[model samples]
Target: MLDKKRIDCFTCRHFYITWDRDFRKGCRAMGFKCNEMPSIVVYQNSGVECLRYEPKLPRKQK
Candidate 1:
């Protein structure tokens, strides 16, 4: 069994979830577009290569 918490990269001390613009940057760096959902880490205490994490954007509604 696994325990998962609801949080983002900026909040957690580990993991990194890429945002829209940064997602693009990551894609460019990886030489591929971020088409497979812009998530960098989905695990706790995972090692990260991201040091430029920013807060997650507020949700938008139609």
Candidate 2:
């Protein structure tokens, strides 16, 4: 069994939803877009946790 780290791309600041239908998600920090989540792609490629995973800041309501 392959061990997978639990990384949530949506919580990272680099994660962004794209307008493209095929590749809906992208990572600004890595400068790439993919159908899979950025963190998952990074982990699969590098076999390690993402180095640029920065947590998104809480939005302040006006």
Candidate 1 lDDT tens digits, 1-62: 12443333344232334565634323222333342322343222244333443455666897
- What pairs collide in candidate 2? none
Model 2, span 1-62: residue lDDT tens? 12755778889998999999989999999999999988888888988788899999999999
Residue-level error in angstroms, candidate 1, position 18: 13
The numbered model that scores best in TM-score is: 2
Cα-based lDDT at residue 20, candidate 2: 90
Candidate 2 stretches greater than 4 Å from native: 1-5
**Sequence-dependent TM-score of model 2:** 0.86
Candidate number achieving the greatest lDDT relative to the actual structure:
2
Name the runs in model 1 displaced over 4 angstroms. Answer: 1-32, 41-46, 56-62
Write down the TM-score of every candidate. Answer: 0.21, 0.86
Candidate lDDT scores, in order, read 0.36, 0.88
